[model samples]
Target chain A: MTLKEIKELLQAEVICGDHHLGTEIILAGGSDLMSDVLAFGKPGLLLLTGLTNLQSVRTADIIEAKAIIYVRGKKPDDQTIKLAAEKNIPLLSTPLMMYEACGLLYQAGIPGVSPANNSNKAND
Target chain B: MTRDDEFRQTFKIKGRDFSHAGGVSTEIKEILQEIGIPTQLIRRVAIASYEAEMNVVMYAQQGKLILSINPETIQIEVEDKGQGIKDIELAMQEGYSTATEEMREMGFGAGMGLPNIKKNSHVFLITSTPGVGTYLKMIFYLDHEKAS
Candidate 1:
């Protein structure tokens, strides 16, 4: 699905990068934990997170996430918004909680970045 | 490229600086992008570098991140002055963490930093002194066939 469809389905507000709404988003992962996102996120993955901090934007950029959808009506500060804009990673705000957001996306045929059968164990 | 043909840069990280955390890693990513590093390799380097930088901001007084790159490899070295890890083996575990509430509030402190770094790098090394500091060196080979 495209980010435009997600925005309409979730009734989300585009906090930044409105120009990027046309971008395609096929995979997503929802988490408040940045480390887990780092571990499991794939390039171009859409990140659905409740954490509204600079690190969220940074994590999205590091993992090459296509965009970030902030759940639970949370929004980041000005610095975080500035960073997101600088990185060209779009930011969207939604009133729904994390679980609901994930469900809606999943129902639309978007899959999680990590497969359910895979273990989270660190191989090191 | 030969050792003589390399790009090197150093960035300083200040502990407890939540406002500016992850900035260095962003710059490093931009540098690597400008140098034409592969997107997949850049993502790996960015993930490992950001994790290392976050550790310094969360636990150290101050630290330095050195990025040295050549045609064959990308290397990152982080040395910090602060309370170091007492048990390296335990710290490398997936769920082990000593992060504070503030760190968690930022969506970190899940105890996956070191292992995540190791998972992304071809070579990972960590050394620390409980009272003194910690040091990390991670290398990623540009050619997967040569990495072993």
Candidate 2:
């Protein structure tokens, strides 16, 4: 779905990358741990997290995530906004918590980044 | 362009510096983008490099990252001075982490660093001495026809 639709659906505030609201996002992943995101996230992901650190923006950029949706009324600091702007990664803030945000997106037809197939496991 | 066309760059990483942990990887990604590498290859390289950077930041006193980019391959060598893994085998396990509260606060240290790096890299090599440090060399093969 287009980020524009996500913004409207979640009543999210666009903190940056207003010009790139039309960017399409194929999958969504919500996590507070940057490690998990790095391990599992892929390109064109929409990341939802409550962590408001600059690392969040950095993680999204590294994974080539389309945008970041800050959940639970969480907001990113100026540095995060500057980095997101520089990377052309859109930032959105929503009052809903992580679970709710992810649920809304899932119910709206967005799939998670990956399944429980455990394909990422070395043993599997 | 072929393997003859290669670019090399080095970046320094300081430990426990959460503020700028991923700076080197970000710079590398920008460089790859400017060089017109494929998006998928860039993402893989960036992710692996960033994970290595974080490992250095969270565990070492300092580190050096060398990025070698050829027309058909991208390789990164990360060497760090700090408490190295006593058991490389255990460290490679997916859920084994020695991270502290401070490291966790930065949204990292989930014990997924090495595995994730290996997953993203086409070639992964690592070595460490318990008290000395660690070295990681990761490479990504670029598809000539696929890369823009």
Candidate 3:
């Protein structure tokens, strides 16, 4: 699905990179831990996270995430926004919690980073 | 620049500087991109480099990240002055961590940093002294056939 469709479906607000909404995002992964994201995230992965900090944006850029959606109505500070814009990684926020946001996206056919392998279990 | 030409640069990292923690890694990524490293390989380098930088910011007083590139390989060396790992074997485990709540709040500290670095690099080495510091050397081969 395109990021524009995700914005509409989740009723999210674009915090940065408004011009990037047309980008395609077929896979996503949610985590507040940047370590897990780095370990599991693939190129062009859409990151769903609740951590509203500069690291989130940095992690997205490091892993080559297409975009980020901050859940639970959380938003990052100005520095974070600036970094996101600089990296060309779009940032969005939704009022829904992490669970609901993941469910909605899953229901909409956007799969997690590794749906079949369950690589996250190794971290558990 | 040709593959045979060597490139080397060093970036300093300040501990507890959450505001600018990952900047060096991002800069490293940009440098690799400009040098025309493969996207997949660049991603691996970026991930490993970011995790190493974060380790310095979270645990050390200060550190230096050195990037070296040659015809055959890309190498990163991170050396930090701070409380070093007491048990390297335990720290290498998948889920072992000694991160504080503040570290976790910043979206890291789940103990995957070193392991993730090792996973992404074709050759990895780590050495530390409990009271002194830690040093990590990671190398990625330019020839994709030798990467695994």
Chain A TM per prediction: 0.92, 0.91, 0.92
Report clash pairs, candidate 2.
none
lDDT of 3 by residue, A44-112 (tens): 788999998999999999988899999999999999999899889999999999999999988887777
Instruction: Rank the candidate models, highest DockQ first.
Output: 3, 1, 2
Instruction: Give the CA lDDT, 0 to 100, for residue B14 in model 3.
Output: 99
Q: List the candidate 2 regions with Cα displacement exceeding 4 Å.
A: A116-124, B1-5, B143-148
* Tens-digit lDDT string for candidate 1 (B33-125): 997988988999999999999999999999999999988889999999999999999999998999999899988899999999999999999
How many pairs in model 1 have backbone atoms within 3 A of each other, for residues 3 or more apart or on separate chains, i.e. clashes? 0
Query: Mind giving the per-residue lDDT tens digits that candidate 2 earns over A22-90?
Result: 988777889999989988887778999989999999999898888999998889889889988988899
Interface RMSD of each: 0.5, 0.7, 0.5
Accuracy of chain B in candidate 2 (TM-score): 0.92
- The digit string of per-residue lDDT tens for model 2 on B39-118 reads 87888889999999999999999999999987667889999999999998998999898999888889988889999998
> Each candidate: what lDDT?
0.92, 0.88, 0.92
Candidate 3 error regions (>4 Å): A115-124, B1-4
The residue pairs found clashing in candidate 1 are none
> Backbone clashes in each candidate structure, one number apiece?
0, 0, 0
Task: State what share of the real interface contacts each candidate retains.
Answer: 0.98, 0.90, 1.00
For all the predictions, what are the DockQ values?
0.86, 0.76, 0.89
Error of 3 at B8 (Å): 1.1
